[model samples]
Structure formats: C-alpha cells, structure tokens
Target: MSNIVKAKIIEKIQGFYEAVDDNNNKFTVKLRGTLKKTNDKLNCVIGDIVQIDVEDNVIIGIEKRNNLLLRPLISNVDYVAFVCSIKDPDFDIINLYKNLLWVDRENINTILILNKIDLVDDKELEDILKLLSQKLKHIKVIAISIKKNIGIDKLKEYIENKNIVLSGVSGVGKSILVNKLLDIEELEVGEISKKTKKGKNTTINTRYLEKNKIKIYDTPGYSAVAIPDYTDKKEIMTWFPEFKNYLSLCKFRDCLHIKEPSCIIKFKVSEGEIDKDRYEFYKTLVENKGI
Candidate 1:
C-alpha cells in the first residue's frame, strides 16, 4: 500500500515545497511524474490543497486547484488585505481604487488597511477614514500602526481562522506588520529609498505564515496594477457596489454610464450623491480599456 496524505501547500523554497497536514505535521515534498498524466499543468503554488504520495517523504502528485492567482501564484484566498501607507510612498486613492477593482474582478473579499497611522496627525488620519468611507462603501478599512502596536488586535480578531493575502504597494511596511502579527523577527522589512521615494522589492516570492489560527500569504508589492479585462464594458460598472442602485434606473438597457443620455450614475455624480473620484476612475478605466 502507498502512503497517500493530504495537506495544504504552505510555501516553496529552493526546489522543494512545504505542506501542512490537518494534524499540523509539516512535510517537504516534490512532484511526481504521474501528475503529468492527469493534469498537464503540474505547477503548484502556495495556498493549494494537495495530495501527496509519500514513499520516502516526497510529493508524488498534485491535485487540482480551487482557483489560482497568475502573477503571485497563490490559490484559495479567502480574503485580501490591501495594506496602504499613510506616508512614505504616500497613499494614493486612485491606486487604492485600482487595487479594489482587481480584487473585485477576482470575486475576492478585501480588507483595506491604512498602515503607518502613527506617522500622521489625528486630522490627517480622520480625513483618510472619511475619504475611504465615502468611496469604498462595501469594503471595510482598518487603520493600524504596527510601529506603535495600535489596532493590531482588532485586525487580528477580524482575520481569525481565515486565509488572507497581504498585498499593497512597496514601502507600506506590510512584511514588518505581518512579522509583528506573527511574533516573528526574521521577515525582511523594505525601506523607502530617499531618492526614488519607492520601496524595495524585499519579498521576491509568495510566503505563507500562520499565527493564532489565521493563515496569511504575503505577496510582493505591485508597483503597476492591471485591471482584469471585461467582455462588455458595461459589466465593469457592476463591480462597483455603489453603482448598483442606479444601474437599473438608466434609460438605456446597456449603459456604460459614459456619454449615455439620462444616465442615472452621471446624474448621481453631478448631484453629489455618488463619489466623483470613483466615477471618474471608472470612466477612465472604460476609456483606457476601450471595452
């Protein structure tokens, strides 16, 4: 009889992959050639649930995935923690919208983190909360200062027992915060360059770490974000939760909300009902994609 065990792919280092079973046993595994017969795509990524045919403590097969992320190569993400800084690679609302759009396109839930709040004044932090509240109605934004150890407990409580993907622009102190959350000191923290005002790519690959029943996959900070393609430009509007109320009120059956006569979305923006910035962002996305 063969030793067949099931586990979740935690991380890959060098050539061997690490997996954690239900019993908390860690196994270092390698792929089996028989995997090629069933699935042509044998590549495995972090956060994948796999079955291992262990003979002498090695991986012999990889099971199919529930879902997969192309760039970072992560799968089965329950939540995405979008970590944004208040300063030092300053917070850009447009970029936040871009990140939200991509996350929504993937049909994944998000938790926006306003990190480094210790660097900002109360008023500045309050303003950020207000702005995020207005534009991101569906998403929840948590303000945290890993340096001061503020709001860490709240964030931890929210992520309890969930698989989270920590993502953001460089220089936002994501790794540092994650290390603090896990009570580990080894994860490298990237510094913001004085000349470029950008963060170094310290995290080269996806890393999986678990703490207090919560699992997190920290991905490399993305400088340039690409929104997912849509077959119909009108479909993009549905991703914005705030637009749903007015979508049915539009005069045309298929309204992209741009240059369409009696467009309820445009009217809402004009009347200060909808966020102008988000509306503008959507318009620009539609125009740039030419969908």
Candidate 2:
C-alpha cells in the first residue's frame, strides 16, 4: 500500500474537482475516477482541508471538512462576507440577522458589506446607515458600488489572505461584490425579476476563487432566510454578543422576554440596551426555527 497523498479541493463541477496537491500543483480530477469519495457528511463546504489517497499519481480519498454551508455545500470557511444593498433590491433586516446567525454558528467572523452605495446620495443614505451603525457595532461595515468600482479596495483588503464565504439574499448584490472583489471579469452574475426585484439565483453551487493566498466561496443567493435550528429563544440570545452580559440578570432561567416579569433582556430592549428589532426578530426566529 502507498502513502495516501492529500489534496485541497478548490472547486467542484460536474463530478470533477479542481484540487491542488500538497506541492501546490493544480489538477482537475474526477471524484469517482480519481478518488473514492464516500460523501460522508452533509456539511462539507469549500476551503476545507481534505485528505486524499493517491496511488501512482491518482487521488483516492476526500477526508472531511472543518465546517460547511448547508445550501451551497462548501467547507473550511474562514470568514463570511455578509452583503446588503442600499437600493435596487433594498435591505431586508431579517435576512441580515440570519446571515449574522450563520456566521456566528460556525464560529466564522463576519465583515458586513453594503453594496450599491452609488444608487443614493450621501444625504439620502445617511439615515439608514446611521440606524444600522447603531444596531450593528463591533463588525466592520464597508460601503461599495461594484458598478463604479468604488470601495472595492476595502472589500479586497478584508478578504485578502483568507478564505471567505459570501452570503446574502438574492438581489442584494452578493455576486456583484464577488465580481468586483476578484476583478476577473469572468464570474457569473444573477438576474433579478422585475415584478419582485429579487435575484434569479444564478449560483447553483458553491464556487471557489483564489488569488494571492486569498480564497472566496460564493454561495447561491436566496430571496429570504430559513432560520437555523435553535432549541430555546434564549439559546439564540447567546448569539448576540451585545446581549450576552445582560442575559445573566434575567429573572427566569427560561426567559423568552416577550412578556416576562423581571426580564433583563426585555429591560435592556426597553432601555435601548439591546436593539429592539433584534429582540423582536429573535422571537420571530424562534417560531420559524422550532419544528
């Protein structure tokens, strides 16, 4: 038996994978023809470090993933680029929360990108941004217009030297930002329906882009968010970094904070200690995520 050679799969399409061997040599190998991929886990995403068995220059094994995106089916993500738009598609706050949830759930840090900034004048967009600034703190928010190529450097710097996963609702400009980031002029763009102004979801699978040691995984855009599995509403509360401390003071151990007495979470919400929209949305997520 020969020693199993390892390869990092950078992209997969139509049963063939573009992988880089340990020596940084890239090859397009068929999954079944080159390696016996058992398809073990459902959570495997791009950017994953995989172990491959090779004999006589043929790959054989695709070990496992550190983490993966459920819908796009990629793994080993390092960071998440959560994009929202100021116009064209507009911002959906609820979807924002889900993107935040997805990143935090996987322990991936996030960088918030506000796209289509050129659509609105500074004065017109100021208020919405001020509101967002108040609600979301501690995370980096970069405003950019892919059309004008403005603010592309900030996005370029953010994902540079790292593996990033792009996530957002359809028509919010996820793909636009991706194209601008790579500057490849070859990435696919999604079309939005005129009636609903929502993206047509061009990306069917997770795809990878790499340059200068930076890797990006672009996920298929969705029109809305499907809440992840969370046991208690309070368990979901822990996801909010700003609310973590106040949670200890809640009177009841199982406080949903909707109508509970001596509820610290509610008090904070009332006192502006917590973002009210987040608290309300947390309740909303509970209803949806719960079976």
Candidate 3:
C-alpha cells in the first residue's frame, strides 16, 4: 500500500524536486503530472507544498499552491523583494516600473530595495530616493548598502519567518544581500564586466537557504523582463497603483486613461500632481499593450 506524506519543495533541479517534510526529512521526488494531464492550472514549483504517494521514495501527487510567481517560477512566496543597484548596473526606472506592474498584476506583496547606497554620494542618493518616493507612493522602499552593512536589520524585519524571494537584474547584489542576511558567504557574488559595464549572471539556478527559521529563495537574475501578453489591453491600467485614486473619477466606465475625454489621470499629469516621466511610461505601456 502507498502512503501519503506532506512536504514543501525547497529546490528544483531539471526534472527532480528537493523537498523537506514536516519532520525535517529531505526527499528527492518526481512529479506525478496528474494535475498537468488533466489540464489543471496547478503545477509543481519551488516553495510548493505537495503530497506524495510513495512506497519507497517517489512522488506521485502534488498539492495546491497558495501563490506562484511567473518570472522566477517560484510558488507560495510570501514576500518578494525587487533588489536593484544604484550605481554599478544603475537603476533602470523603466524596467523597475515593469517589474512593479508585474507584481501588482499578480497581487503579490512586494518591496523595492535600492542597493549599493555606498557607491553614491549624499545628494545623488537623496535625489534618487525622492524620485522613487514620488513614483512609488504607499509602497515600502528600503535603501540598503550590502558592503557597508546599512539597513540590513530593517530589511530583515520584513523577511523574518517568511518565505521570501529575492529577484532583480544581474549584479544588483542579490546574492551578496543573502549572504549578509544568512551570515554566510557560500553564495557566489558576480562581478561587473569591465568592457560592457554590465553585471555578469552569477547565479544560474534557483536555490534556497534555510536558517534561523527563515526560508529564502534566491533566483537567477535577468537583464530584461518580458511581461506576458495580456488578453485584455485594459488590464494594463489596473497595474499602476498611483492611478487607483483617479480611476473612479474617469468619465468612461472602461477608460484607458489615455486620450480619453475628461481623464483625471491625464489632468493630474498636466497639473504636476502625477510625475510626467511615469505618465509617459504608462503611455508607452498603453501603446504596446501586448508586451
């Protein structure tokens, strides 16, 4: 007879998943593919809780997930930190906005981390923070310097005892931050290319670190984010958190908030209430709705 055991996936390698049971026993399991065969939306991913039908040590079934991330392909992540460097790779606001939209659409709780504060001067750092503050109102922004060991404690408060995922572009110091938080230097930190001035991808695979009752997932970094195509073009506007207050005030019931008559969002942009750069970015998104 087969017995069922509950386990949470910690790492996924090729066709195998590394999971730990409630009793802290590690198991290498294979998927039953039952959910996929039925065309169900559920699929196995790292950070997922699953039940396995095993006579010895093989997985035959998977449980449902509380949540999932498309880009990094992680499941049931409680918190996601979008880590970006201030100087080395430079903060790409456009890419950052796209990431924010992706998180918002997924309805995931996230925070933004502007890393490498030690590389910039006081004035420059202040300006960058001010710009981000205006664009990202109501969202927490933690400015941290991994090398200088600044703001690590405050950052830890958010991720403590939570299933957290660290995602950002290459060389943004995601691995370095993890090392600091975990208090170990096992994870390799990549160096920026001298010729291209871009960060080399250090982490090629998704890995998890469990320590001090903290579960952290470190994902490989990407140069560019390819947002999945939307079935409905109007869904784009809903991703912008800043537009929420002005949404009900729009004249049309299904307003795109661009070139529409009596558009409150546009009015706010013109009146300097909304950042012009952000509005332009939103316009760009509206123009390229499929992307």
Candidate 4:
C-alpha cells in the first residue's frame, strides 16, 4: 500500500526536496514526472505546500501559492525583513529603496531591520532613522544591535508566528541574526573582507528553519539587488506608497509624472511634500526601465 500525505517543502538539496508533513515527519522526495511536466504555473520552491507519496518518496502535487517572489524565487512569505548594516558594509539607501519597491510590487508586507546599531553613533543613527521616517512612513523600521542585545525581543514579537524571509546585502549579520533568534549556532557567520570592506557570502543557498513557533527562510546575502522589469511602466508609481495621495491629483489620468505639465507629484516634490531623492529615483526607474 502507498501512503499519500500533505507536506511543505522546507528545502531543496541536490535533486531531492526536504518536505515535512503535518506530523512533522521528514521525507526526501523527488517530483513526480507528470507533475514536473505540468509545473508551468506551479513552481516547486521553498515554502510550497505539496502532496507527497511517503512510500514512493515523490512529490505528487503542489498547491497554489498565496504569493511568490521572483528574485529570491520563494513563495507564501508573510513578511520580508530587509537587513542592513550601519557600519561595516555601510547602508545603501538606494538598494534599500529598490528592495522596498520590489516587495511592494508583490504586495507583501515588509520591515526594515538596521543591524549593527552599536557601530554607529547616536547622531548618525538618529539621522538615518529620521530619513527613513520621512521616506518610508508606511513601513515599520527597527534598529537593532545583536551584539548589545538591543531590540531583539521586540523583533521577535513582531515576527511571532509568522513566516518571514531575511534578505539583504552580504555581511549585514543575517546569519548571526538567525542564530541569535533561534539560539543556535548552526549557521556559519562570515567575516568582513578587509580589502572591499564588504561582507563575505556565508549562506550560499536558501533554507527553511523553524523554532519557537517561528518559521524563517534564510537566503543568500546579496551585494546588489536588481529590480525586475514590468510590462506597464505606469504601474511603477503604485509601488511607492508615498505617491498614493498625489497620484489622483496629477494633471492627466495616465500621468507618468515625468515631463508632464501641471503634475501634482512634481509640484509636491518641489514643495517638499515628497522627498526629492525618492522622486528622482522613481523618475530614473520609469525612464530607464530599471536598468
């Protein structure tokens, strides 16, 4: 007799997937031939719920995903915590904005985690927080020092009972954060390169881990994140939550907000209602197609 069971794909190693069923039984399963052929719309990725034949150790079917991230290629994520460093690798505001836009396009919740707060002075941290507050008023921002144990408990509270993906540039202490959160040193922590002053890549692949009722996907750190292209350029503005109010007030119904006469978004930028840097970034994306 063959046993069919529901499971969640936790990780993919080699050609087999590590799936866990409701009873927390682990199985290394391969995709069924027919299921792989019909995987056009359904991708077998981490966080995917599937049906498996335990006896055959094959993934028989995949359920529809609630949401999918193309760049990281993950599915059904409740939140994306973008981790950044204040000192060693330095904070890249442009990259952070790019990440925010990417997740916003997917309609997923986001939280900005500024790690290594201990390295920066009070004034510098305040300034960065102020700037973030002005531009990302809709998003939640958390300043934490894993070394000093500051804001760790608060971070845990926010992500309690949720599935989150920790994403950011390399060397921002993502692996360290995971170890701290899970109270385990299973993940290796890499040191910053002396020559480039950047973090070395410690996590080469994405993995799913669960502890204390929290599920997290630790992804490989990235130095630079590229925003995916969209078919409709007009849709770009919708991702910026700050542009919501003035969008309707624009002169034309289909205003791209660039080189357009009587554009309220432009007028707001001039009036300081919108951050000039952010507006400029949007214009660059719209004109250059995210090149």
Give the number of the best model, judged by TM-score.
4
TM-score of each: 0.81, 0.78, 0.84, 0.86
For each candidate in turn, give its C-alpha RMSD to the true structure in angstroms.
4.2, 4.7, 3.7, 3.4
- Give the lDDT ranking, best first: 4, 1, 3, 2
Best candidate, lDDT: 4
> In model 4, where is the ten-residue run with the lowest total lDDT?
187-196
Give the per-residue lDDT of model 2 (tens digit) for 123-185: 877887788777876467788888788888877876787778787776776765666566656
lDDT of 2: 0.68
Residue 15 alpha-carbon offset, candidate 2, angstroms: 7.3
Collision count for each candidate, in order: 1, 6, 0, 0
Better of 2 and 4 by TM-score: 4
Writing each residue's lDDT as its tens digit, candidate 4 over 1-291 gives 548888889888766899987677898999888777453534588889999987888888899999987767788889998998888888888888888887887888888899999998999999999998888777789999998999999999999889899887767877678888887854433232442244343666888888887678988866767776779999889888888878899879999999989999999899988989999899889888453
Off by over 4 Å in 1: 12-17, 28-44, 56-71, 186-201, 245-249, 271-273, 289-291
Residue 25, candidate 2: C-alpha displacement in angstroms: 2.7
Query: What is the C-alpha RMSD, rounded to one decimal, of candidate 1?
Result: 4.2
Candidate 3 lDDT, 1-291, residue by residue in tens: 438788888877777779988677888887775445554333677888888765656666666767777777788888788899998988998887777776776677888888999999999999998988888774678999988889989888877888888888877877667777887754433333342244343666788887776678887766777765688878877777778788889889888888789889999988988888888887888788543
Return the candidate ranking by TM-score, descending.
4, 3, 1, 2
Runs in model 2 deviating more than 4 A are 1-6, 11-18, 21-24, 27-40, 43-45, 56-71, 186-201, 231-234, 287-291
